[model samples]
Every structure is written in structure tokens, then in C-alpha cells.
Target: MDWSKTKTIFILAFLILDIYLAMEFFELQDKSDYAIIQEATIEERLAAEGIEYPDDLPDDINNSFYITAKSKDFTIEEVAKLKDQTIELPNVNFEEDQSFRTLNMILDKPFPLPDVNTESKITQFLNDNIISGELYHYWYTDEEMNSIICIQSYNSRTIFQSKDDHIGMVVLHLNEDNEIISYEQSMLEQIKEVEEKEAAITALKAIEALYNKNYLSSNSQVVKIEYGYYTHSPLSNQQILAPTWHLTVEKEDEESEDFYVNALEGDVLQLTE
Candidate 1:
């Protein structure tokens, strides 16, 4: 028996054993970690993304049931009332966006907004130059209150108790002197009541749907889910505001995606940013 050859064989055998054991250890560890993660509850998952469970979630939501809600609309009388304000602007140009049914106005000379309170300014502007309606609510204004003014539609029954639900299609852009430089207004031609508004699915259910469809990451959290109106176009210049469930889901890195689910029909509406 050569002692040197015997020592080499022993060394090789020990190295192989060590490598096999290390591989087995890692495989076991991986499975254990995955099992722990898979056992996490929805709350736990949401917590990981720094989101809290919503307090007003319904106990059990039925997809088939319906809820009555009103859509945003303006009547001929309302339009005439707005036009009756006798808005005066020299060399003002108007262009219509066919897709959104919004009239984009560009002013040759900016009109100075009132230096009074924001509410008063808004009221005066609507009464003096633009339309005034109960449906439009003051949504947002900057600290200076001169750069931008956002107004959204709201109804008592359908407005969700979430900030995300307040995004409006009506916007007013102003100059440094709080003057109206330009504005985009949604032109709704008629008013009609929707009697057959269907009940929307719950926010949690919407999140689950996104997760199951792989649209949401398991590492993501449900940030916001609110009832709102999504603009849908059936054809050119024919725009309809459909009741929708808007969801905002985010990952730990804060990357988020917006999803709109048709509340009445329970269908996902395709959106373009």
C-alpha cells in the first residue's frame, strides 16, 4: 500500500462529500424560506409594502348585485347658463380634442384671476367666464393658487372616501399673476340618469384579480382602491364616463400601476397613460 496515493484518495472523497452536503443544505433552506413566504396572509403582504388594511371594506361582496349611481352630465340649460356669463377675452382660440371631448382654449392675453380666497376666485371664474354646476367640486390648488386649478365631478352616493378618486378631467392653467392662460374643459352635451348601475366589486377582490392575472407582483401592496368614473369612448367624439373601480398597487420600490375595472359591467377597461 502506497501511503501517498492513499492520502490523495481520502482527500478527494472528503471534498466530494462536503460539496454534496452544501448543495443539500441550500436546497432545504430555499424551500423553507418559500414555505414561510407562501404562508403569509394578505395583511402581512400589504404590510410588507407599507399599506394598511382598509377599514370600510364590505364583509362579503357580490359581483352580481347592482348599486345606483349618477353619471356626470350637463344639460342644454346648463350650457346656455355657462355661455350666458358673457366671458370676455380678446383673440381667444378654441380647439377641440376629439378623443376626450374637451375644448382646449388658448388665450392671446391672459386674464387676471382675483386676488381673493381660492373658493371665491373659483366661484367668480365659473360664474364670470366658465360654467357653474353642482357636479363640479374644487379638487386641488397649489400653494400660490395661481398655477393650476383642478375641478372634478362628485355625487353623494358614489364618491369614494379616497384621495385617488378625485382626479378630474377639468383643469385650468394660469400665469404668475393668477390669470387664465389656458384651460381644458370636458364638454358633456346632455344629462341622462343611469337607472341600472351595477354594484362594483370590492377593492380586495380587485387586488386579487390583478394578482391572479400576474398584473400585480406578490411583493407589491394595495395602496388605493376607489370608486371613480373612467372615460370611455365608443367612437370618435362619442365619449362616455363609466363607473369604475380604480386600483393603485405598488411594490416596495414604489413602482405602481393603475387599473380600472368597469363597476357596472365587471370588465377591465384598457387605459392609456
Candidate 2:
């Protein structure tokens, strides 16, 4: 090989490689800048519409698993352990499996659940009075139905109530004295988390989903946003629970309502009360 020609060829090859790397770096930088711009625009747009979300919206993208569960199926022997309450099974002997799903109970005497400092007081009543109630957590009082609502929990997350007959909720009917009279409980047993957890859509993305769907009106205040499991099947015997973003929105002069956004799908769940 001619020494002068070989040196020139080597220099040309390195020059071409340097040019290619420079182009790749610029392209990546442009994408990063575009993403930041898009994020800022969304914040400004929400402000223009007078919609408010939490300033401390989680910056980290969370990971979660999709779960599957069965309706509470029990045998007469298992349910016989419940005492001081009249028990009724709605879906008994499901498919000749000799198992029941729903549990309706009327207390023999009113269980004392006071209205004051109920955070601790109600917890006490549940562990002492209700059977297997240790698994249930106080959700909220439904004044419209005159009931104290509780939801089943797992892994430190309680299934949020999106509908009246939620499969994981216990609807406790209150008598005239606001005491525990009776309740209907449905549980999701054998909950199995699907394989590896995947990154979930951000809370900001969830809120934007609602706004895109026209669920958020102007002057709407997003009071709270929480991550949990919520199901769309209110009456299904078996259900799939997905990670969800539960948002509490309040419009001016309007009562606050709960809205859910599927964290995985990034769509507003058109769930009903």
C-alpha cells in the first residue's frame, strides 16, 4: 500500500464516524427538549382553563401489577364461625361448587360505633364485632344510603369504592340511631398479582385524560389524587382489578364527585355511582 494514500484514507474514515455521532447526539437532544416543552405546555393550558391539580403531583413514574381475584366463595362450615349475626348468602352453591360469594348479615344487637373520633373507634368495632372484619378498612359514610362503608384491603392499598355494589365493599346499614344494624359484604379472594410490575402513567397524565374526555369542567379543583385498585365490574362473580388513579374533583358550587382514571390504559373510567 502507498503510505501517503493509506494515511489519508484512515483520516477520512474517522472524520465520517465523528459526523455520524454528532448527528445522533443532536437528534436525542432535540427529543429531550421537545418532551420538556410538551410538559410545560400542559401545565400552562391547565392553568388557562382554571383547573387546579396538586402541586406535589408525583414526579416519579410508579410501577404496579395487574391483579385477578375471585368473588368470596365459602362453605357453610367456614361461614358458621360468624356469630351474633343472621347470615344470608346471595349466590350460594355457585355452579354446584358448594361455595357462596356474597355475605349479608343482620346483627342480633346494635354494635356500638360512635360518630366521634371514628377513625379509631370504628376500627375497634370492626375487629370486635364483624367476622373477618380485620381485613376491612373504613372508607366513608354514605349519608344518602344511611350506611357506613368499608372496603377490603391488601398490601396496604384499599380498593376504592367507585360504585354502590362494589365487589370488595361492605355496605353497613345504619338504624335510626346511626348504630351498626346490618351489612352486606362481598370479598375478592385469591388475589394474584400478574408477573413483573410495569411503569404506570403519571398522575398528571391521568388528570389530563379526564380533561381530554371533558370530564373536568372549568374552575374545577382536583382536591385529591391517590393510587389504588379499582374494578369496573360491579356485579361480576370474578373480576380483574387494575391500578387506578382516584381523583376527587370539585367544581364551584357543586358537590365533589369521585372520578377514576385507569393508570395503565390512561383512560377515564366511565364508572357510575
Whose lDDT is greatest here? 2
Worst 10 residues of 2 by lDDT: 89-98
TM-score per candidate: 0.51, 0.78
Clashing pairs in 2: none
User: Which model scores highest in TM-score?
Assistant: 2
Model 2: residues with Cα > 4 Å off, grouped in runs: 1-35, 56-61, 88-98
User: Which lDDT values do the candidates have, in the order given?
Assistant: 0.54, 0.79
| Tens digits of per-residue lDDT for model 2, 1-273 | 799999999999999999999999999999999999987787788899999999998654467877887878656676667778877655556456565566678889987766688768778877876657788888878888888888888786777765456677777888888788888777778888985788889888898898888988899999988888887765467677888888989987777878888888887886566
The TM-score that candidate 1 achieves is 0.51
Error of 2 at 256 (Å): 2.8
Worst 10 residues of 1 by lDDT: 157-166
